[model samples]
Target: MNYTLHQLQVFVKVVQTQSITKAAEELFLTQPGVSIQLKNFQDQFDIPLTEVIGRQLYVTDFGKEIAELANEILDKVQAIDYRTAAFKGILSGRLKISSASTGKYVMPYFLSDFLKEHPGVDLTIDVTNKSKVIQSLENNEVDFGLVSVLPDRLKVDEELLVVNKLYLVGNKDHMPKTAKETKEIFNQVPMIYREQGSATRLIMESFFERTKIKVKKKMELTSNEAVKQAVIAGLGYSIMPLIGIRNEIYNGELQIVPVAGFPIMSDWRLIWLKNKKLSPLAVNYLEYVRTHKADIINKSFSWIDLAQKAHKH
Candidate 1:
């Protein structure tokens, strides 16, 4: 019972990461330091919080319970800190965000103004696949999560930030210039595909399913940049978000295929757990995004028009 908040924080990190080494690296503590704290924490309760099997960390049922309670305690502490800082008219705290990999192209525009306005805030942004982003949000590991696909299983509050429009793109010489020709060509040409679990890939698959077209996937790449490069090399076509490919399209390295049912639109959303109480800093950020989302999204995508003009000239 005589445990410090730091111990609880470390324990929660350990549970979330499932690695003492990873937890230490995240907390900026030595690996042995984290191990000692975790041991002391378990000794206080006289119950094993975690077990290691085959070099993998597993949280016991008791550990899971404690970790949930630790999260609650930490959330409340953060709320209190936020309240105090609000009273002083000074916003200062950490803002942790986990975003789907594709969100990297858009989130910086949304955050750039906020970060400049709140100079005292410490910010951390983690970009990963959509599944991991949702996992982080479910565990309350981040203040907010940015993704295009909303999870159905988790109860969350979400705000639609922008529309992510995906386009079928390929080398200009190879892609057909009209929707009819592109549709006819789609079944014959090999396509570069985003790796499984990508939001873009999922959307593309749904489009193909609806259109009843069987695509010949030539390569599966893990990142957007890789997919673009493969397409540039004449490997195949890919469905890519316009936000991520404006530069390439403008530079004449790639062009959007005017395929039927092209430009699949998906909603990009900012989400957090519905029942969890947000700190003042978090609330401020959420409110700012809600109020200025239109402007932020407009500015973020203004390049699309410019890119088109550049391509024309």
Candidate 2:
């Protein structure tokens, strides 16, 4: 019947991580500290909140329900704290962004500086598929949407950050040996595909159709990392954003094969409804991204241009 907010926070984190040690790491507490708090909190309840079986922790159904309520409580507590900071004349409020899954590779770089400049700002970023990202925009659920391919249905203002180029990549063994071989490479190498609604998958499909290249679908995955790992493991070749797979290419685990017509280009843009009322926090974030976009690209994404050039020939 009696519990502290810290106890609730620790319990919710334990429920999320399913391990006292993992929860301790995230909370920056010692393992024994987390375990003691979890134990003390659980002792207040008659029914078991968590159970240990075969040395693995599992949250009971009631524990999950309680953790959800605890998370909501924490969020409200944060909102109150931010409001108090605003009262003290500090810039503080929520800045929410919904981004397409692949945009994950770029969005963080764009946000890092703004977040550092506004310590009081609360950020909620949803990284999902293009459809859900657009749907979130349409539903007015977020202040901005980060997308590589613009949605035709949305009438939005955009901050164009950087050029997004999708390249055909495979392990070294599957690469084309000559310019002529580039046109015929798909005949031998199987293709790994992103899930149906991803912009990458859509662009790759359109390219294949337009070029009349027969593709053998090796498998379909729901995200960029999954497809990239599949390609790295020699499962199949994939059309991936060079931004996401740059490290693998540098490490020689993947190679960009120059197709006769390749590197499908698009722009990653931060979009907001043309006339949506802007929150102060959102406005500041907008200014921050618009002003620092070039610097962020030059510093964090300087490799993109070089990579493109290497495979352009």
Candidate 3:
């Protein structure tokens, strides 16, 4: 019944990945080293923690239970560390944010300076789809949420940060040569789409529906990056935010093709429940953003303005 934290970590990782090789790779341990740690961990337990059959691995039901407990223990241990930093007069606590997936490109710019100044802050950022971002806000699960579109049903206050411009993009070699009507262009090249409920997908859909245009829908992908890759492979074109694909445009791998109603725009917003109490850490982070957002946007995000100028009609 005795095991070290190291053993618990190895066992938890093995349970999570269900593969010795993947656990080892993620933990930066040699495969043999991980195997030995796992074996040592299992030695202290009575019942089976894992099983192998036909070269596939499965964690026993008991193993899943242990892994969950071990994860809780690890989180408690990290909390202790954060508390220690607080005792030393450093700003310490959790600063958690759940962001929509495309927000991966935007949130870091806003967070970097604050995080750099407060190294004691234990930061947790979850980059997920739009619904999950809203869910996290509704449940009070995170200190903040980042999204380009405000949820109609949520009673939340938002701080506007930056402009998010979505454009019709395709692989440079595969796009139409001249500007065409929105519906015609969509028909000329099959439209790659983000999965249902994605904000960008809604924008694209509503835009076409309003214009009374019918588009040929090809592959439906779950993520912005996935849709971009599909377009780059010449499968289809998609509407993508410029923030996420600027490098591809600069590299000539992708192009922001011109159409009549070209750039769809939204504001990137930091949102939280209207009446929710904020932790001191969250308050400090918000203040930093309130004061520094403009400066950060001017300094770090000037490239966005340059990209916008090119899209101007």
Candidate 4:
């Protein structure tokens, strides 16, 4: 059987996305073109690699094995490109990253400087929840995964990028101004919660467990923005990352409820699979983050201090 690396690349993306249309879009090729390449690649082996059921694509068992091998081949090719670019004293390549939904607020600030400095590097970011982000890391689909909570089950390397502090927030008119008052009002007030599998939800649950406080959960929403809007409309209270609610807090649409043991802190980490070999681009990004973590943290969270001051006045 004979196939080009480009065909393998296309096939791998098709499997990753589970949709030919999405794969085509990412590859910047027409759907029919991607389909033709996939057909040709499969014909060489005369085996079914994928099938569609109920409008959803599913990779065959054999396809899973092929995808694994394809990933290995692609990694080696990327390594060669990285090494060549390094020898030429230039850094250039696509850098794929996955981050938890909440990281949507934080990662861009950290990534902005890197993108500006390494204009040759192409960047792709997948904003998803914690579970999907970890799945991408485990599959070696991304160079890095940004999350506040590290999975205990995955063997991975992690770098602490910053501290993520969560604040209990609600509509200004509904929120109590002091810790003791908020504690007394907790069980009586309806609480809007992030959906299951959210890092913020997990952290909030852990906080509740530790404090022995029970919440009257009224609604579950999929995104931070949704939860924020719900709280703004006076539906309920929510524990949200300080990064996500700074603007709302500054504008007085939301106020941090001074709940006991407020600002539950967690470490925001950049993670990658431990045994996976890093390409030069990945290595450079890791080093850049490590060397400038302090600056990244200060720049990212300086608004928190300002927001607090604004809230006081």
Candidate 5:
């Protein structure tokens, strides 16, 4: 073979640990054996893959390039192993995922149950806005992303998970006194906005345009928690995911306001690379969501309704 899989493994280990001795300990090999394997790979390539910085090993630029490719190759090899195990009736492995902010409201609820049923699978989650989550998906930093915004030129495979309504929220105490009064004050109160490129902001803006309404924004913030806190603190009012603010509404911290002519809807999407292979763990986790999404949504709506009723009481 080119340098043998063991040589590549040794080289990757050294690059990852940045210490030949650590790599040797991790790989259950002697330090000399690890050094020899690395040297063999370097000899095959006719250039040093790594260099010594003081006593620490540093990966050369060429080594970094190979390390990147090596990660992909290793991922593919693990995928093959997962596929074989799946064929023989096993579901296991790690599944890294990313999601937009609003997805945080619903994804955790579903993911918790999914994890309960599939204890063998490890899960990692990164919560961010639409743009960064998509970027992470594109960079292969995550296996898939749950997003509310769909880009024009999506370079990934996507499936609609569930669609949820966006809502206009304000502190009940600041809810314009009455509906007509609210309309007049709506333009007066500062409209709090999420950071730019937020799916919620995009949807809200699109809704305003279609309804021919101009909302005056008082300020902008980067987090749902911050936006909700500002609204509750009576600093300004804003739009947010209905599901996300259910608890706040129930606790009388926020109010859901209805716009006369505006429709607020967002589709939550599950996205992955177009030609990438999914490990069994990812496939099963996704399948679990697909099968139970309706029930999940229903349960969520029920909770919100209950919260609303309690608030009214």
Candidate 6:
């Protein structure tokens, strides 16, 4: 029927306290006003809401069911109001993000700068393997992700962020002199590799497949940092994003080896659900990345080159 929210509100309040006077006090209305509103509510529904049993109000089964619906409607209204205010830029909110392990090295720098500019926005960053990041995005657990290798199915929409070249990185002392030397060293050394579902591992694998050569792996780890550490400790060499290993290579802790017949690289993407609703703030963040996409890629590779030179004897 045609019932107003005010009537539902009064009915809910009276049912909650089981006392007209108490409901009126809570609602800042006189007892008679609450009683009148409750009567109008019941009249609209063609049902009796409560019966007086020795001055105590007891709700009917129908009344309880209707009150449940009322509560749900009120909750939805409140949520709408909150979202409306956020859209107006009056309320601040947090955006949850997930990213592949390699992103941990560069994504945070970009986020920190963004947060500095938008003090009203909050952020939560989850750094994990590429597979987990994609899984989280698909499960609707995170608003966005920075991923290395995306699914071929293209179930999500992605913004091109950067182009990254893969490098066979290792400790400076164990650096290879040429592509042949690199392959020989790879065959001899204990090669640390990323776990399955890793974009870095996939890139390396595809390169090997193209060249008709298989490089044996000595260890498999989930953490990109762990792989970097192992390589620095002379355990083995591994493929990694140039941006990620810049510092170590520049500091003479790691060396970059060019593989023969392989110059494989992948595009970094900022991804989100194709069908999910994006908040205004989330859209703003994506736009910011698009504006600086080229700069970000150039900066990443620039560091790689400088780091490679520093590692030279």
Candidate No. with top lDDT? 3
Compare the candidates by TM-score and give the number of the best one.
3
- From the highest TM-score down, the ranking of the candidates is 3, 2, 4, 1, 5, 6
Better of 1 and 4 by lDDT: 4
lDDT of 3 by residue, 181-299 (tens): 55478768788898876878888888888889888888899999999899889888888999999889999889888877768889899999998999989999999999999899998
lDDT of each: 0.85, 0.88, 0.88, 0.87, 0.78, 0.78
RMSD of each: 4.7, 3.5, 2.4, 3.8, 6.5, 12.8
Residue pairs with clashing backbones, model 1: none
Error of 3 at 84 (Å): 1.2
Give the residue spans of candidate 6 off by over 4 A: 1-88, 176-185, 294-301, 305-313
Give the residue spans of candidate 1 off by over 4 A: 92-100, 119-163, 171-181, 194-199, 209-212, 218-235, 247-283, 290-300, 310-313
Clashes of 4: 0
Clashing pairs in 5: 191-218
Off by over 4 Å in 5: 1-89, 181-185, 304-313
* Tens digit per residue, CA lDDT, model 6, 61-81: 999999999988976776676
lDDT score for residue 220 of model 2:
95
Query: What is the C-alpha local distance difference test score of candidate 4?
Result: 0.87
Alpha carbon lDDT of residue 226, candidate 2?
Answer: 92
For every model in order, what is the number of clashing pairs?
0, 0, 0, 0, 1, 0
Clashing pairs in 4: none
Q: Arrange candidates by lDDT, highest first: which order?
A: 3, 2, 4, 1, 5, 6
